[model samples]
Target: MISHRAPDSLSTWRAAILIAVIALLVSCGKPPPKEISTLDKIRTTGVITLGIRETSVPFSYLDDAQQQAGYAWEIANRVATAVKRDLKLDTLAIHTFVVTPQTRIPLVANQTVDLECSSTTHDRERERQVGFSSSFYLTGPRMLVRRDSPVRDWSDLRGKRAVVSSGTTAELALRKLDRERGLDIEIMLAKDIGENFMTVETGRAAASVQDDVILYSNIARARDPSAWQVVGAPLMREAYACMLRKGDVPFKRLVDATIAEMARSGELMQLYTKYFASSLAVKGGVRIDQPLSDDMRELLRQPNDRID
Candidate 1:
């Protein structure tokens, strides 16, 4: 026969039992975080929601009637076609969601969009929140100014205000520039590129900072391309990639493969040629739509490459 424990000992033992029960309940109460399934979701949905910028022309933007059109849109269409094949569906609705750099990942996390085809940079901080595709286009950061603006370089922004896109790498670049040169310039953020250009055009802001390629593309697509100018030198080299939810390996792999296939087939080149080759009206000089540079060309060559 076992003897009974002292009162204090019994109390301690009882508390231990209570703690274990509480722990068990806590473990069982909450459900695990939802796992991201790359294949099944696409198969069942029969649609791919693509995140695109509404006004970033030559990459992803609206046409005259405000319908989606551009190089990035073309890429999205091809990816949608492949997804349709996987689902055995004849036609999949290519739903387009307008997103900014700041909102892109949050939308993906919430399943508001299947993939982001907008101009997005892959950074360690961003990777912690979402997965990134291989670099689709690589370029350097540059500035946009009116034809008669006084700003010659990034340093010229000191004691001046520069317009930047809200929640973009451009804004971050400007911040870094501010710190390095100890410039006291103020940075203003615009809701979109259209407004950003307007900031400089109206003389409200001295210049606009952006990716060199995007600034060039914008100038190429402008109504009167000669009215504005892309000024200054490249401040930083950037590699733009498509963004997806973190941990969705299969979907990322499939997209990488599709991009590679397009590159190999020369379809990517054709798409770029179709949309970005024409130069829009401008002021200072004729802004020729340059051919795909070496960095972008290399990006096109790497099919199925993943970003770690």
Candidate 2:
């Protein structure tokens, strides 16, 4: 049988072939990967996939018929309308995708959804991975406790455990507070807001830390409002925005512009009032004042500012 390797000449030939293969791979023109913008995708598909929360109460939740409707849902529908107009589509279909706190970012990044109008916390760390719309809502961290619980403020939880939703900005804010303030409070994470608040409900944890908006909305959903109380001073101010994939500059611009237009025309305030304000005050005794954050003012002036 002929020798598999023809001595040094065969070895040289194999080495050359390997180098050529690598060069071919390096120089391969594979369409430079498909980098489609949200706007482009909308135009191409004639559909907008909006990611919403499944159990976020007034933000985005299922009704009796299990259809999506809430403040976030309405806002997303408005944006979808603007998107359809921008793309000059005959009638762009709006698709709803339920997302939890943990899956929102991944869904946006993977293009499973075009825009995420869920109750997502806007932060610098998250901005690295996904784009955020102009801040339409400004909120802070708050604690929910039993009506009879002695914990009235943020400082009362020295040794007690504070429950928060897992993989959420509330948990991150609590951890940061723990390190910065040297607070010895044990931070516990629940799978969701309902679970986090359940800790307080069952008296298993001293308190539950979460977004003030979410807390108020959840309280409104509760069958017994007198059983639990949202306690303590605001721990941290966080902004909420519509999230999209990062590097979609065109998409980001369009989203920003849409928000600015809404703010300029006072439509955003109306949405907030219609969904969040009166409901909270009348039902939960929480009055969310207007122009809560600087973003509100800036958005009023320039609604399309790039938050990321």
Candidate 3:
């Protein structure tokens, strides 16, 4: 995580230090809850705040005009529709904010965004600070490596340097594996997905580790797509879902119910086809059709926020 501070406010050094220490202790990495509910605030203001990712391809990403597009963005549109109807409003304006990997969780916790419609996974650790809607997609950890590299599987990358975005499932899994297996792999952290790929592509790291789908998206955008190959079995399972603030049961119920309705009505399949069935022509254009794996199909049968 990046931390910034005032260059030098040393005129009253002792007072400044005391205030900074107090502020840090009070915040404690989590934001305080707001009295007004997310839905209530939205209805009162006639606008829904959505947090998006400009680099999360086939999920939440920005197009040439900076308008949000992709699978997650489309799903968010449906949720917005549901919210408008629920609030008895003909139309509600959407206030979109671009967020990086490090900031999305805090943004949701701080109530800066009503819903984060990006490719955030529903993991138990993340559940502690924020709430999640029903699982929308499923993926697993994988690696992207140079085509000519000898690494082909977990065993092959025994002592290699791997890069993952900070605060991601990939990083968490890698750290755990490194400790448990005594692999002694050098783990490097990147600020976001884009840099995660760069760390590998530039040969500074041996592999770019992340969710399989995300790595595939990066490969499609790579300068030399043919130069990199996605290898190795999945390290761990991941359930992708939208993120919101915790303790908002009413808002969560509405979001989950809306997702369930979409799934039951086949509207979800339409969206799945729209983004994954055909060749995705986004900034990082690729012909990757990641259909519902058997596990994913079963997840649709029963949707919940629980990671397990």
Worst 10 residues of 1 by lDDT: 279-288
Please list the Cα RMSD from the true structure of every candidate, rounded to 1 decimal place.
10.3, 8.0, 5.6
On a 0 to 1 TM-score scale, where does candidate 3 land against the true structure?
0.86
How close is every model to the real structure, measured as TM-score? Answer: 0.75, 0.78, 0.86
- From the highest TM-score down, the ranking of the candidates is 3, 2, 1
The lDDT per prediction is: 0.75, 0.75, 0.82
lDDT tens digits by residue: candidate 3, 195-258: 8887898899998889988877777777787898888878888888999888798888889998
Residue-level lDDT tens digits of model 1 in 25-88: 9978967767797567777877678899876656776766556776777787777888787668
Query: Highest TM-score: which candidate?
Result: 3
Better of 1 and 2 by TM-score: 2
Candidate 2 is scored at a TM of: 0.78
Model 3 alpha-carbon miss at residue 110, Å: 2.4
Residue 167, candidate 1: C-alpha displacement in angstroms:
2.6
Model 1 earns a TM-score of 0.75
Candidate 2 has its poorest 10 consecutive residues by lDDT at 281-290
What's the lDDT of the predicted structure labeled candidate 3? 0.82
